[model samples]
Target: MRISTFEYFTSGVSTMNNQQASLSNLYAEISSGKSLQTAADNPLGAAQAVALTAQAANLAQYSTNQSSALTSLQQEDSTLTSVTNVMQSIQSLVVNAGNGTLNDTDRSALATQLQGYRSTLMTLANTTDANGNYIFAGFQGGSKPFNDNASGVGATYAGGPGQRQVQISDTRTINVADPGSAIFQSVSSNESSPVSSGSAANTGSGTIGPVSVTNSNDPANSSTYTITFGTTTTGTPPTTSTVSSYSVTALDPATGTTTTVTPPTPYTAGDNITLGSQTVAISGTPASGDTFTVAPANTGNVSDTDIFTTLDSLVNALKQPADSTSSLATLQNALTTAGTKISNTYNNVLTTQTAVGGREQEVTATQTAMQTTSTQTASNLSDLVSVNLPAAISQYEMTQTSLQAAQQAFAQIQKMSLFNYLSS
Candidate 1:
């Protein structure tokens, strides 16, 4: 086969150029320590790396969200602890006010202390987070939740009903705050004793005691009983005697039923009158037409369970004179209600605190899991794109050697060309 000088030179040049290109690629892989520099190097690996990068970005955002959620929850938790302490102090004051020996002046001092506590509670209810958002304002985070009402008796809640939540993970969300209404306004009462009171219009010296439950499971415990006093005449005209008597009437609000409960029974001072599953004593002489009422403590009404109103009412009653039987009865009733409401509010606050702690725990766990996932994803991505240093270095050295040999051979071949041979 006869080969021309042009063909020989062209073939040699092409072979050397290809070897140099391979050597350059190996050098790039060695220097950069990356097996795949572009998509064309490994399309499947590059696509997988893109997905992993996006995942890492999402994970980073979730971590940020988790941090924010933890901060808000921690703030709420701390505020609720303060509230619980204040509530406990208020409860102690209420119990002290219940002492029969405490006169109006002593009671007034207790009331003053309660007012201070009320102020503290109001501040706690309007607590704000690091970002200046109200923690208990529900969805109205930017607005204050509780403020003193015009009457100066209780606080008004201007927040929404919906609790705010933060997304901690892709499928998980946690409540970061609780509404003021849930914590303060709409507390539940656990008092078993029915509330009893003499009618304000009663002209009698009659006083009634708190209801004592004899059968708690009885259905009658839910009914409101009214005791109406009357005078009955027994005997002939000249020897006629008037007997003080009372009749019971029951109203069941759930079924909207009102019924005359029992026939007239003669009244005896200091005797207990049975009303359904409960009994209350009339300790003083009751005039004819006087009435007293016994009602369930928990009426399942929001207005009935307001801690602020309960406290305000007790404070006002404490400042009043308990010189008369009726006044004393009113004071006793106020103490009972206040004690019950405050205790229930304390429990409610504790429940809210527990929930906040639980959410904090969940957020912490999610952060740990997210961290682990992020580490695993990063490892997978590294495995896909990272160069094997030892293997790449060995391949680079071999390619460099081959390129050097090709260069030397091309130099010798160029000198052996026919024009060069004639010159020789």
Candidate 2:
């Protein structure tokens, strides 16, 4: 079809304008190094990039959480290690105190050394993190977990029961620290042993020795028993004789029932007396009305599991003069109790330390997995939006050439007309 000059000229100009616009867009893409600067460029790719970017943000946050969790766990593990060392020293001292050769003065010096270790242990228990938060304070990170009690013997836990946790991944959460009560104030029931004591009010030289388990399955292991000393008199006044005897009264904790061993058993120094599942030896002549006790130390019993209190009591006992058989028995009992409690405390600390290590491993694993996913996410996001420099430069060069040719041809055509042809 025949076309007017005006229409042809307008069409030619429009084609050049379209070429310029395409060149400008390619330049922008190359300059910005992003192929999908706007959703209009590639709707699907832009949407995918958005999703990937959000995922990357979440991954970053999770990485931060993992770092924080690792820091806290590391701090706890280190502090617990120090605590275990202190406990080991204390255990050694307890064993040394039990040596028969050490005099009261030497024992007192050892007690002083134990006090130093206790102070060290207290410091370790109140350890703080990089942020100055108490590591063993459970959820009460801002509060100190343990402090000396009124008697300056043991410590009181001031923290909460629930441990602090951190989310390391989308589906995984980990404990950053253990509660002070769990670590320092509790012992496993299966690991606990009965504690024995002579009545503080006893007027006799009679003292109870360390308890030994005669039957592991006996229910009396968990029972409380009291040994009462009595006297039996017989014959005429001029030739009258008296024999010392003892009666066993047991209190069943589960049933809350009290049972007395039928008839009084004769009292003998250094003889083993069976009380339920356990046997305890009594040494030194017990006078009438003297009594001793054996009580179960169940799990979570602070009286038995508190390492600080055990140490404090042992220190006090060691400082006392063992001038009599009763005093010596008392000192030996303290040593036995302290040694057992220290061992239990050491085990508990190890268990807690293992848990912290596990958490650290979990966090490290999660971080590795997240790093892999993050790399993939970044690659996908980059592929969807990033410009390929070599390919973009090639296309840009071609477009520039095409646009220049179009403008040159338009200029040459504009010069062509009937009047110019006639003049030539």
Candidate 3:
């Protein structure tokens, strides 16, 4: 092979340039501590690294979401516990109020204590989260759930239905808050009694507080019975009643409207008033225009009520006077009905507690899974992009040697080149 001067010089310069470029790339790798700086370096590895990196980012975000969900649920759980305790205290007050041995002075004191519990329960129902959202307000987190009733009787539910859930994991969502209506207001009464009493507005001096179910087969009996004070008028055919009988108006508790119900037969003083499953005797010469209500204690409307309204009603029933009728037996029935309502309320709170626990378990599991996935993804990413320090150093040294040799050979060849000879 005959090599011309021009060809030899050109080839030597090309060799030196390529060696320098290799050295520069090695330096870049060392500085960055990355095996490959761009996708061009290793297309398959780069693609894999990209997938792993994205997976890691998603896992980290899921972990964060799980943490937030757990925190909110825990806060809600603590709030519910406080509410249960408050209800329990209220229950104790109700049980104590039933003691017939306690007089007006003692019963009044118990009622005052019940009022305090109602205040505490309202505070709990209005619980808030770290972000200032009301926990029991469902989707209306920014709004308060319970407020004083317009009638000034008890706290009313102002929030939406149940809570809205957040995604704790890719597969599952969990409830973070339970509203007050489901937790407190769902309690219903077991039987019927007087919810309202006749005032002087009704001409009848006769009074009735609450009625009792003395017979069987009337568990679901919700018939409404009323007593009109005026005596029955006698006609040629004795249309209304031969005796001075009080008129009875029957109502349905489910409808909350007036309907025909069987009035206690005879309707005389101290007579056992029987209407469906309900029975109560009324006495005390009732004047014209007086009326009394006989219905169930649980009106099934807790959305606007605190469970303790029945307790307050019981207290009021106890204080009512005994005017030869509607005092002793009526008061006893009220106490029993109030106790039933409180019991139902307590059961609902317990059910809510169970639901909270279930949510906690779900969130905790999701957190663990996300954390594990993040850790594994991070390891894979490290392998794909991170440089092996010792291997890089060895390769860098070899590249440096190659570059130095190229420079030395090029320098020697320059003296013999046609360009140098031509210049000389």
Candidate 4:
């Protein structure tokens, strides 16, 4: 097979060019430290790397979110701790007030201290985060959580229901706050006082008649007492009777004389009575209910009142000497009730703290799983498209040597002449 000189020269040039191109590619790989500089170099690997890089970026964002969520949760936890302390203070104050030895002056002084504590508690309930958002205000972050008249009327919560949450991971969210209102205002079954009303009368003495009271005055006080009668009703009307100051006398219908009767304690909706010679016992003080009515007798009535307000009234009542023993006892009951409320509130705070801890654990676990997955994905991507420096450098050197040899052979061939052929 005879080959033309031009064809031979062209084939030698092509071979040298191919070797140079291979060396250039190897050098580029070594210098750039990437096996695939462009999509064309390793299409599949390049595509995989792009996807992995995007995933890594997303993971980084999730990590940032997790960090922010953790900070917020920690802040919330701190605020709750402060609130718990304030509640404890209030509980202690309630306990101090419950002691009977504490005179009106002592109680009034305690109430002053209690009011200060209440103010502090209000401030805690209205606490804000670093972002200046109220922590206990639910979505209404700009609003205050607690409102008060500041005059012993007690505090009221103005914020919405608890609904704060934190995004701890890409797919998981957790509650970061519980509302102050729910924690402070939850009513317990034991705390509620049932409704009662009635009228009572003294039959044996002078001016004995049915005494009507209102719901506000029902169970007028906590002290238990009894109504005593001196006589029985022989007949009706215009009865004149003599009775001991302690005895409650009723008017006789026929004899127009006084009859003694006994009163019952904790008088229910339908209680009837007749005067007797002996005294009748009642468990609780007489007070009117919402529907209480008397045919003809005393006309004073009471209204429905809660423990907090009752204690407050008692504190002020102690300031006055005319305040009845019944009112004092009512105040005592209110103090007891307030104590229970304080205890329940503290328990609720504990419940919320427990929930927060569980959520924190969940966030930690999610973060760990995401970090591990992201790291493995990044490593796999590096293996697919990243270059091995030592191997690339060796390959580049071999290609360069091949190219030099091709160039020398081509030069020797080109130097061939007719004179050289004749001498040989």
lDDT of each: 0.83, 0.83, 0.70, 0.57
TM-score, structure 2 vs. true: 0.88
Candidate 4, superposed: residue stretches over 4 Å from native: 149-162, 185-284, 287-323, 416-424
Give the clashing pairs for model 3.
192-296, 193-295, 193-296, 203-289, 203-290, 204-289, 204-290, 232-245, 250-259, 250-261
Tens digit of per-residue lDDT, candidate 4, span 1-424 = 9777788799899999999888888888888777887899878878888998888888888887777767767776777788678777777777777676777678778767766666666677788888888888876788887676478555566777867776656677777766766555542332322222122221111111222222324322222223332223333567654322223334443344644343322232223422221121233333322111111111111112222333344345334332445545445444543454455456666677666677777777878998898889888878887789888888888888888899999999887767788988
In candidate 2, stretches whose alpha carbon ends up further than 4 angstroms from where it belongs are 3-7, 203-220, 229-247, 254-256, 260-287, 299-301, 422-424
Q: Which stretches of candidate 3 lie over 4 Å from their true place?
A: 4-7, 188-300, 303-308, 318-325, 415-424
lDDT of 4 at 161: 84
Which has the better lDDT: candidate 3, or candidate 4? 3
Candidate 3 global CA lDDT score: 0.70
RMSD (Å) per prediction: 3.7, 3.3, 6.5, 11.7
Q: Ten consecutive residues with minimal summed lDDT in candidate 1?
A: 186-195
Residues 264-376 of candidate 2: C-alpha lDDT, one tens digit per residue: 87677888898877898988877788888888765335857787888888888888888977677667656766776787788778888887898888888889989999999
State every prediction's TM-score relative to the real structure: 0.84, 0.88, 0.72, 0.67
> Which lDDT value does model 2 have at 130?
79
lDDT of 4 at 185: 52
Ranking by TM-score: 2, 1, 3, 4
lDDT of 1 by residue, 115-233 (tens): 88988888889888878988889999898888777896777789889999888788997888899998888653343356676675676678777668888889987898999999888
Candidate 3, residues 152-208: lDDT per residue as tens digits?
655667788867787766677778888777776664333223343454344333545
Worst 10 residues of 2 by lDDT: 296-305
